[model samples]
Target chain A: MSRLSINQQTVKQLSLPELIRACTAVGVDAVGLWREPVAEYGLVRSAELFTSAGFSVTSLCRGGFFTAADPADRRRAIQDNRAAIDETAALGAPVLVLVAGGLPAGSRDLRGARAQVVDAIAELAPYAAERGVRLAIEPLHPMFTSDRCVVSTLAQSLDIAEQFPVAQVGVCVDTYHLWWDPDLDAGISRAGERIAAYQLADWTTPLPAGVLTGRGQIGDGCVDFPAFTEAVLATGYTGPIEVEIFNDELWKRDGAAVVAEIAARYPACVGTAS
Target chain B: MSRLSINQQTVKQLSLPELIRACTAVGVDAVGLWREPVAEYGLVRSAELFTSAGFSVTSLCRGGFFTAADPADRRRAIQDNRAAIDETAALGAPVLVLVAGGLPAGSRDLRGARAQVVDAIAELAPYAAERGVRLAIEPLHPMFTSDRCVVSTLAQSLDIAEQFPVAQVGVCVDTYHLWWDPDLDAGISRAGERIAAYQLADWTTPLPAGVLTGRGQIGDGCVDFPAFTEAVLATGYTGPIEVEIFNDELWKRDGAAVVAEIAARYPACVGTAS
Candidate 1:
């Protein structure tokens, strides 16, 4: 229970104040937030609210979209990411997750797009490090490779992360995005301390249109959570385990009810160590 | 032109006779086939139609689904696959493509499901070889890992293929399924002689529900087709390059127009050598 955190997207309808109240009611010690919601609630006020309620911000949702064909657009993306870094710092969140952007319009050069990601991250990592925020590269599923994030595997994320200081850059391990990988266990082991954040969601079938917001809640799909938890625990990772499901059905329910259900379902999914 | 083949699914509305006439009109020398349509048209008659039209059947559409949990169902799948091998031989197709099935209902053991695929292929390879048919493992996109196919990358398919004689087992390389992989070139180079069927389709976003029939037409999306063709050709593969898109819009169009569009679009996408 001490290690469990509820990502706000899991209960997207909940207001910041309502979310804090629900977390307190459910005894959740931490929360992961998305940039838009935090901004909507006023970043400083949200930060103050969480801090006052004795809840830690595990991570800020995102800070990357560096692959653009236009040079000016790319520059703007970098600036936006810098703002995200500042937000992470203001919220007292140690990790800022990055979803490397997809291929630019009419550009089929995947390698070139990937190189841009590396260059963008290299430029941003020092800034993040200086602000005391770790940039966590979250590899989306390969289904998102064309339109969302070009980084589609933990190994690929690590390849980029290894080029930087471990304290400043690392990979985010999310089961929903990586459950099908044959080399997952080895990648997780190699990630070790470079795992800046660990997230939970299950792999469900008949993926929705756009393939986003289809993540299954833990125990609702085919992810072997115990095995994943064991693998992460073996890495000596004692950080918060955040539930970050994005199902449309789950989002439609009352926020408190969703939190209650998550609390009830979480214990069996977490490994023996937790 | 000699190396070009139109997979039936790319112009699925056409009957066997219409497909033959359209391919002949378009100067396509080969056609890849699906089991249901061929069976519907009469396997012997479909084979005769292609042969009479001087068309080589590049490969059979599919012949794998070995992840059933029930013993009887597993046995049935094996038996059905053996029949498919016979069909491949009867059609004089050198390759029989396999889409390894997904996890068993309610089972979270991905490794177990994958192991089952290995065992099923091991059991079927000898029979296929005896029929002078090479079993080509088609690694589907990871999006299909849960419900459609567990084999999700060319490397993983090669790992299973290497266990058998290359003459008996090979891999089907489809650009739509593998364009996202950073290691694709290396995988293709390593595939060298084990490359059986090479396919083409572009990667499009906002994927429809089920993520099945949403493949973009060639040149309509972000896949770098030339690079893929070059990689495969670098491996000395002088085989049929099949265009196999499964777009809903394409499916609704006139079959002859679809083939004509494919013919026009294909020249720009194929390698210089082809």
Candidate 2:
């Protein structure tokens, strides 16, 4: 249980304060948080709340949408990401997960859009490194390539991350997004120390409409969690193992119950004795 | 127009006879067929109908689902594929597309399942070759890796296809599935003469439930058709370019209108002057 962390998204129904209290009661010592909820609860105050409860903020949710076609929109996105970097630093999170946005509206140049992502990250890496926050590029599943993130493979994310200093930019390995990858084991091994954050979510079928909130709980789907965890561990990563599921059904349940269930399911997946 | 072909699935609402009439009316010289409807309309009769109408059977829709755990089930799948090869030969189709099935139920050994696909293909490749039918392995999008197909990349498809003789086993390249791949350009180039069929379908957002029937018609989504066609052409593949969209909305419309629209949209995507 030393490495276990419950991502705030796993219990989206809980407020920041309620989340901290629930984690304390459930004996979860760490958490991964989202930008919107932290801002809503007041960034500094939320940071203090976590500190007071002796909880470590493992990572900040996101900070990239660099695929805008308009020059002005691209600049604005960069600015927004800089602000997100500051927030990550303020919250004492070591990593800021970057979900490289989808293709711009009406633009079919996927290669061009991906080039823009690399350029945007190069510009942001220095800012993040200076602030002591690592930018973790999260490669979404290929299904989200058009509408969400164009970085659809762990190798693609590494292609961008390798262009920057390892301490500044790294890849976020999430099982839900990469479970289908044939080269996943090799990709994970290649990620090595470049793995900034490791996340777990199961892949359930008959993917819900929109496919955004369809992630299953740890044990509910087909992902081989123990194998996935073993691969990440083989990378020599000793950081927090965050369970971040985004199911509509899970969101409706009590936050405390959700966290408790996650805690219970963590050991079997990560191969750690409970 | 000579190189243009319409897959039967693009206008699934039409019966075999109605589809043949609609394609003939639209001046589509070629067609890719599905097994179920062809069987329903009588395989021999369907072949005769296409031949009488001066239509070339470009490729047969499917012939693989070889990931079953049971020995009997695996043998049955191989037998079914042999029958499909016979149908492809009888229909005078040059290629038989294989959508490799996903992991066996309650199993999480993705690598093992993929290995099984390679073995199954090897078992059927000789039979297909004997019938002068090329087994075209279709690499479905990674999203379908768990449920629909395990061959989730053109490279993976080629990995298996290359194991057998190129004349016996090749690959089906569908823009909808491969467009998101960062390695697509290189994969297409590597595929070279191993590309047995070239398919076109755009990638639309807000994927409908099940994700199977969510493929968009040409120019309806973000896939850069001209670019994709150029890549395939660069590989020296001058085969029939089939338009195969699986859209629920399109299925609700009139079949003749759908074929007409497909014909109208086909030239621009394939780089042919209208």
Candidate 3:
């Protein structure tokens, strides 16, 4: 059976220890942890619990929020990312997903925001490489360009990755963010081995308030899962499929039920190995 | 004074006659017509109303929803576009805005959807060329990619336009739809003289239920209007600045009031001409 990873963001209602217990109880092969929860449980303690429970830590929730108005703010973001890298290494997570932050507060210059992101990533790349954890820049949907992320296109993400010589900087392809791109196939082919993590979620209409947290569950929206998964697989990424949803409604449901739904949805995204 | 063009879709609440009266009362210099309204008013009568009121027809509302499951359906779309072309000539609009339709009814194949769009445009381009009306393929926001239009990027729109001679096919650069593209400069520069129309509107959060009708008035959202206008101007486009908003809330207010707001908002988007 293909491995199933439950992203902590999908079940923020639970404590890190509770999330670990939930993962084990739900037949989840892995659990993806976010920084706050891990810090709350203490990274060492959380890692031990997962290892003891036979749950692999697929990936660290996130490490990038790079765009900032001032050089000092930018430096602070990089420093925080450095700590996140350390946390990922301690937790035994191979990858730390990077979400390029949007336009700096009150800034309308998208070009300037993008430049800050590149600079921040470049600064953190070396430190992350030294820590033995890869940084995967996740390109959010274009709608989030203003307040969430400026890197709205896969080509844009690949362009940023191309800037760094070391392969430590790669891309995290999340279905909800990228199913709309016209050049997706070409982008997947170009990414090839530079794909660090493959995350799945669905895109739906009537997106909720706090747009960041409205992601749909797999098979809950219009995205063609089988096709999207096949394209990413064509890039030769055989890593564990991580189910990441940010639905407010889902968080209110029973954690075990949500985990079961994700487990069922995981195979729909990627075909089950016979 | 800078020219103000009214797109009918923005004031979809009013009948064609009332819409023209609203425009004339507000001193709107131009108006964009749609097929249903024109057909409802009859082409000759619709042409006479605009002609008598001395309003320049900036562009036709739309003509492309090309992706279809069957060849017959595709043929029907082409024929409908021909009728739209005829109506554009009747109303004296120099440009016809084309929105490439979304995925074929049940199909989730994005690439295939785009290929169908190109073929439909190729088929319709020749007819529009002969009719003296330029086809302006408007690239919609990615949020609408599933149910509205498949051409989600300016680069993709221009790439399609490049397939034909400059005069026959072009793209409409609508600020509300394309304000978030990372490559806005390069895309606008590539559009250059092939830009058939330059439309304006703002992007707002808590988007309306009918996604197609939720555009904000200029200066109301996160879009950098001065920069957006400057980018279009840098492309050497000296066309009429069309203000189009599909807000149901705005439409519920007096059409004249809405027109006045657009007139007031226009200067903010494109500062007073020197």
Against the hidden reference, what TM-scores do the models get? 0.99, 0.98, 0.91
Please estimate how well model 3 matches the true structure, expressed as its whole-model Cα lDDT: 0.83
Candidate 3: segments with Cα more than 4 A from true spot: A14-18, A25-27, A70-72, A272-274, B13-27, B206-210, B272-274
RMSD vs true structure, all candidates:
0.9, 1.3, 2.7
How do the residues B115-140 of candidate 3 rate in per-residue lDDT, one tens digit apiece? 99999898988898898989999999
Ten contiguous residues with the weakest lDDT in model 1 chain B: B265-274
User: What residue pairs clash in candidate 2, if any at all?
Assistant: none
**Candidate 1 C-alpha error for residue A25, in Å:** 1.3
What tens digits encode model 3's per-residue C-alpha lDDT throughout A101-164?
8777767778888888888888888888888889898999987887778899888999999888
* Interface C-alpha RMSD per candidate, 1 decimal: 0.7, 0.6, 2.3
- Docking band of candidate 2: high
The models' CA-based lDDT, in order, is: 0.93, 0.92, 0.83
lDDT of 2 by residue, B1-274 (tens): 7888989999989987788888888787799999999999999999999999889999998989999889899999999999999999999999999999998998888988998898898788888888899999999999898887999998899888889888889999999999999999989999999999999999998999888899999989999888888889888898998999999999999999999998887877766422
Ranking by lDDT: 1, 2, 3
lDDT of 2 by residue, A23-54 (tens): 87868889999999999999999999999888
**Candidate 1, residue A1: lDDT:** 79
- lDDT score, candidate 2, position B236: 85
Which residue runs does candidate 1 get wrong by more than 4 Å?
Answer: none
